[model samples]
Target: MAKLLFGSLAWFSFPSFADNKPLNSPVDYLSVLLSLVVVIALVFMLGYIMRRFNVTQQGGGQMKVVGSMALGTRERILVIQVGEEQHMLGVTAQNINHLAKLDSPLEVAQPSGDNFKDKLTQLMQGQKGKTHD
Candidate 1:
């Protein structure tokens, strides 16, 4: 009886040892790394193609920001023109509130690229920020 039990236990132990042998090889690890790189590259390529083609960008004519003011670091007020009508909006980090409907639209700044760069530099140098009337 003791011999039979010992034989059965030895048989089970051999199978468990075989199972513990590392199933993963260097080739399997390399294959997984290559697959991850391929997926990341495909995502970046798709993003570039979308930007280059300007996919899903609507032509601007329906609405535009007339003007804006910074009340605080995280708060702002903007006048937005929607078609023929204009609206005043109070903006915060969490929500936007309609403040009023303006009787007259605010004068919007139409700065050229170079002019805007210069203005930004001047503002950064601690000059009094120009207010658009």
Candidate 2:
């Protein structure tokens, strides 16, 4: 009874491999590495193809967002350029409202002289001064 039980346990403990190769062989590792590289390459290739075809792009036709500002947690003002004209719109979670049409579109100002970190430090200092007063 002891011999039979030990034999059955030993048979179950070892897995049966059809190829008769060691589990951690170089060929297995090479195959796994090749498969990972192929999968990563395929993903990047698919992304490039989609971007090239504009399949995953937003607002590429006639309308473009010129500027936007958030008024509240759920409300925002957007300046969108359509064809040759620009329109201001009030956007909320529930609805969108057309505000006005501007003769010239708002141009984004380029930061000069100070870098972002310096500007941020100045803004923090200004806010602190305002709070003290």
Candidate 3:
């Protein structure tokens, strides 16, 4: 019985040993290093190009109209003033049809005020009165 048990255990251990060898080789390590270097070089090249061209100039200079009311209720058109110039943008289906088509960055500054909740409550009460009819 002891011999049979020993033989079975040895047979199961041989298959496991065959599969336990490491899968990666020296060439795999070299390939990974080469890829990392290539990616780093590409990123540096992109940074150099951006710095040389001055892409940041688009946001600061003279006023340019960059937004318009295209497709929304309440005539919600975005009007932006840059430096001195002003532009009237027609945000309609005839235009880019979406805000994403605008070329300039539009940021919404936070309003600094208290009593916003009171104003909201009043507006909600007014709306409730209208709906009751």
Clash count of each predicted structure: 0, 0, 4
Better model by TM-score, 2 or 3? 2
lDDT of each: 0.74, 0.75, 0.55
Candidate 2 per-residue lDDT over residues 36-111, each given as its tens digit: 7987999999999875654633466898777878899889999988888999999999999999999767874444
Candidate 3, 14-109: lDDT as tens digits: 333336655377665665577679879999999998756534443445554454444464344656555533334445445532233435446544
TM-score each candidate.
Answer: 0.40, 0.39, 0.29
Off by over 4 Å in 3: 1-23, 60-133
- lDDT for model 3 comes to 0.55
Q: Over the stretch 1-133, how does candidate 1's per-residue lDDT look in tens digits?
A: 9878766756534332336664367765675577679879999999998866546533378887877788997899988989878999999999999999989877766656454456788777754565557
TM-score winner: 1
Q: Number of the top candidate by lDDT?
A: 2
Candidates 1 and 3 compared: the better one by TM-score is 1
> Which residue pairs in model 1 clash with each other?
none
Candidate 2 accuracy as TM-score: 0.39
lDDT of 2 at 60: 66
